[model samples]
Target: MAPMNIFDNTETAFQLKSDSELERAYFLFKMISMEPLVKIGSAVTKFALNVNLPVEGLIRSTVFDHFCGGVNERDCMGTVDRLHDVGVSSVLDFSVEGKEEDAQFDATANKVIELTLLSKNMEAMPFCVFKPTGFGRFKIYQKITENQALTENDKEEWKSIESRYDKVSKTAHASGIRLLIDAEESWMQDAADELCEKMMEKYNVDRPIVFNTLQCYRWDRLEYLKKLHQRAKAKGYKLGFKIVRGAYMEKENDRAIEKGYKSPICESKKATDDNFNEVLAYILNNLDDIELFIGTHNEYSSYLAMELMEQKGISKSDDRVWFGQLFGMSDHISFNLGAIGYNVAKYIPFGPVKDVMPYLIRRAEENTSVAGQTSRELTLLKKEKQRRKL
Candidate 1:
């Protein structure tokens, strides 16, 4: 293989100095590099106007434009076409979050179903992702997970949750679009897992129509993956698993410490990386029985997966194995993987601007948390700026 620097290939192409687009990226990096500033700004804004303000313009100019398809399904069509032009596809993930009402849940479910239906006609969209919390109350999920007896009202709410999922699953199945249930915080995860398993049994019979995300940073998740695989095998159905390093390590650890319980997170980053690679190997080894989605921003992990495919004699274009990155974080990985003819798709998120504030805040915090992320972005912008000067 020829020597390749993916970042150089990706970042150097767009001139940073003369490019207005590149300057906007510099501004975003500066904003997200300080967590205290982001938090204080968010608090002030929320206090001043009892609503999530429009942060989309800042996001759109930098992260969203680079990573997301667009603000809505209609807006994302151009993104879909562009990715398809390069042999990649898109997965629609509605970015709205933090809903507590049954009516809101029902509406969110309906929107997902509509998106799935729309995806049926669009060749570029192969998968649709949803969060159970988007349609179910968190406290209700907590109660069920804790084995609390449900009151009549709670039972009615649970029924609505079931119906909402059913609507999404049925639409996705009918439309031939896959559904990926995103993992949530550890406290609320048991219920989400139960719900996902139920959905899998119903919709994943003939094929793996629904996937449950497994965060490998959780110490128990590798074993969970194995157990899930065993269940799928015994049931004589295919299993779909989306493996990720995780999104909420800090929160999970802090809560565990506060409650005086054993932390569910891996003890170290190495441990998480090991578990992630092991799960990747296991899925690839059992390729016929499991469909795998490798979701990460780590370049080596992505490369290792490709290497594993070569070792196992699996084609790089295998439909069962996919490479996914969040909508706004890793264009270098996504675009280069797409360039190499791999089965790649971005997790495209969209909603009205205010409803997506939580998602945006997390994105900012994550970039800041990952050491060197902002600096790396700054370096790339600076390098590209200097290159333009040449």
Candidate 2:
């Protein structure tokens, strides 16, 4: 039989979308392609939601429908099933942002554990994700990283944070579900990294039950990956790496400039891509002690990963390697790769419309910042729609 070509089958890629859904997606990307409009529209949407204007329906049917799985987990079930039909797994993410109170922390932690419990025996939902700040305050992390001494009360608070993480990770491990600790900004990352390592030490004895997201756009991540693997090997644990090209590039640059320090990010996209691919190769070489999830929208990176797998003679369905993209974007990469019997999953973030505005704004900004991303989505979508009419 001929070798599977992978990632040119738009028919399977768009099988999940209807004619109207396809039109809406095309229109959405076309609008997002206009950078200025996305910025202005994001600001307008934020304002409208701030004062409790009645725009939920408008927002829900447009961008929310296009990007998010739904307003809640129950609302996301249909999307989960559709993705399963096409052989793609779902990594359900709670997309709500910006909560700081302790009660809020417990609530978010409960919801995350709830998500893990819900996916316990489900094949369609193979993984679940949680942001560190979702379960605890970000300032606490910032303070902890600043090397400041903690007071008696501060010590108690730190204990609470640890408990929260323990609860979530333990629940995921117990439920036989793999969990990802999403990466934050460089400033707050020290704590997230430490926590992930600790959890890996605990639950990753037999297999990788927890994963840490590594953003390769940062200049030091290649070295960081090396150090992480060294520690994992010395400590006798499996390290799960969900590697991406980094999301907060512009923000990282602005902060570094303001703070008068060299940027942590790479100077150019090529450098970031180079670092990413190199680290990925390193992971494949160490698959005995590592598992990898290549989370990228870059087609060449995807091709490179497949090539590496062939060179290494690893089975396409090897549990040690997987591919992931966010929901609603990169359909060609996700669905086409999945259809070819490779392990592929998409991050399907779901939450209330108003609460998820931050995520929506970031999605808009990402499409604008990443050159050709929006246009690429538009091109593949147009191809599929045209092919559909035949």
Candidate 3:
């Protein structure tokens, strides 16, 4: 009933550094936490992508450093090891973005398979994640969702999309790697959800190999989750569900307004948070039929889920439920949860720096928009700096 205090141990939370690394990490964190730097970096990324110019250097040194594991899988080995050392696992996310061609789609699918194989070979990497847009054209996805008839070319495109998912699902099943299909924008999401369902049916028979994301910020998502659970039960397969407060809120609302339709987004943050916690409760209570990944940065939601597990007498090591945070933004939450014996993983995104600039820019923009996020990071860095003076 009481609110969760995310920073219960304020002293330890602020102690990000020890003797040697204190000054350097503090300065880096302060620089990344600055509002103007994030704002300008976001603007430059948008401009560069619009004009088709290189943005690797600027992005790599700024937002990418704060958010992403590294620029490639090989580059991320050290990061994965460091997190593993501290008791957290890694979810390998190939961060390639904005691919619109058939060749690129096929390549992305193959890369995801390769990543799954790599994760299976590593003890520390437990999961792999992909975005449906990475392997399908957005317009094609929108058309499918709308039930529009397809031309020969469109049918072929859809076939390719199906083939890509099939390959990823099959590979993941073979590799013993859990695959998370991320939720996307509203227009394309219906098709994405359908594809994920198909994959789950094919791959999650004995164990949950494919997990579909549910964005609880959408007003319709609670009903959708219930329907998906019913379908999973009827099909005699366990459903893997990852819950999050939606990302793409502004874009979804803008599109809805432009098209003269009611927005799918919840009217306020409270509504979204309420739905998120409710979904968490449902999955935790029905753990036999469902596997859940609590993908959130919100402290209240995360701690509440943990408390629920305790109340249900679930073990801390239960693989049926896991917690995830993005690679860069919430080290306090991720590291502290890991330290407290939770099954936690950081979503470690990696790709060519230029290719992942869009992701990096979004991280910058999100940190700027989220209340107290930048200030919290700044305060932690300053506190660490002062601690080193002792």
Candidate 3 residue lDDT tens string, 1-390: 323665444354434334544444455556557779877766767788668787667666655666777877888898888888888899988988888999999889988998999999898988888999999999999999989888999998888999999999999999999999999998999999999999999999999999999999998987998898899999889889989887788888999999999999999888989999999999999999889999988888887988899899998889999999887656677777887788999898888777887776776666666677667766765665565567
Query: RMSD (Cα, Å) of candidate 3?
Result: 2.6
Best model number under lDDT: 2
Per-residue lDDT, model 1, residue 78, is 77
- Backbone clash tally (model 1): 1
On the 0 to 100 scale, the lDDT of residue 235 in model 2 is 90
Against the true structure, what is each candidate's TM-score? 0.92, 0.97, 0.92
Task: Check candidate 2 and list the clashing pairs.
Answer: none
- Runs of candidate 2 with Cα error greater than 4 angstroms are 1-5
Ranking by lDDT: 2, 3, 1
After superposing candidate 3, which stretches have Cα over 4 Å from the reference?
1-39, 46-55
**How big is the positional error of residue 57 in model 2, measured in Å on the Cα after superposition?**
0.3
Candidate RMSDs in order: 2.6, 1.5, 2.6
What TM-score does candidate 2 get on C-alpha atoms? 0.97
